[model samples]
Target: MSSTKNENCYIIKLGREASLSERANELEAAAASGNCRKLLQLIRATGSKKSDVSETICEDDGMPVTNSHRCLERWTELFEGQFN
Candidate 1:
């Protein structure tokens, strides 16, 4: 599929996403790269941000995270896809 950016896209200031979004993305990427230390930092930093992380994952289709098991499964799937 051809990539296209929506011209009408605009940020919603009414309801901003939680800060954990960035950390989650970083952690996921680091995990894919097999960075154990980064992954641990991510888990530790995720303390009070768990809810935001879960909500973001649930809402994003690219990151299918329904349950804890599914999250790990999906992460492994993505990691394997990247390596192989």
Candidate 2:
């Protein structure tokens, strides 16, 4: 039996995908190269100025807040206070 053009195209695509996905070890080794801190610094350095405000969130009492919920509450409070 003969396959159609779409079937042949799909088979070729699957072969290419399978070959590309076979580099698990290389991907893992690249990820474990220990450049995480540098990557984070680069991301932060390129980030917008608006994001800087949330980078060091603190409560009204002058205590640093790490909790996501508390940070959101602090942001909400600040945003709401501007209207009053």
Candidate 3:
């Protein structure tokens, strides 16, 4: 981490992972924009969630599939119930 022009909001440096792909770059761009809705749309349109994992994800018959609107809705509902 290095401070610019003195201090008070120093930039934290991250060691780059050399294997980053094009899709990873796009996702990073969307994430860096700080607009959650746009990132969500990109993720939804591309179905990027859980797509890179090597593990097999077996969804139950009634469970919401990953990267879908239903999964997002289910997550929101679950969190609302938990915190409310």
Report lDDT (CA) for all predictions: 0.65, 0.71, 0.60
Instruction: For candidate 2, give the lDDT of residue 51.
Output: 35
Residue 65 of model 3, lDDT score: 62
lDDT of 1 at 70: 70
Q: lDDT at 71 for candidate 3? A: 63
Total clashing pairs in model 1: 0
Candidate ordering by TM-score (highest first): 2, 1, 3
Higher-scoring candidate on lDDT, 1 or 3: 1
Q: What's the candidate order when arranged by decreasing lDDT?
A: 2, 1, 3
lDDT tens digits, residues 1-84, model 3? 354543533322222233235557777888998878878876786674555644233244665366666666666776787999
Q: Give the TM-score comparing model 3 with the true structure, all chains together.
A: 0.29
Off by over 4 Å in 1: 1-18, 49-84
Instruction: Assess every candidate by TM-score.
Output: 0.35, 0.35, 0.29
**What root-mean-square deviation over C-alphas does model 2 reach?**
12.3
Mind giving the per-residue lDDT tens digits that candidate 2 earns over 3-29? 688899999999988865655444545
Query: What is the Cα-based lDDT of residue 33 in candidate 3?
Result: 85
Error of 3 at 84 (Å): 40
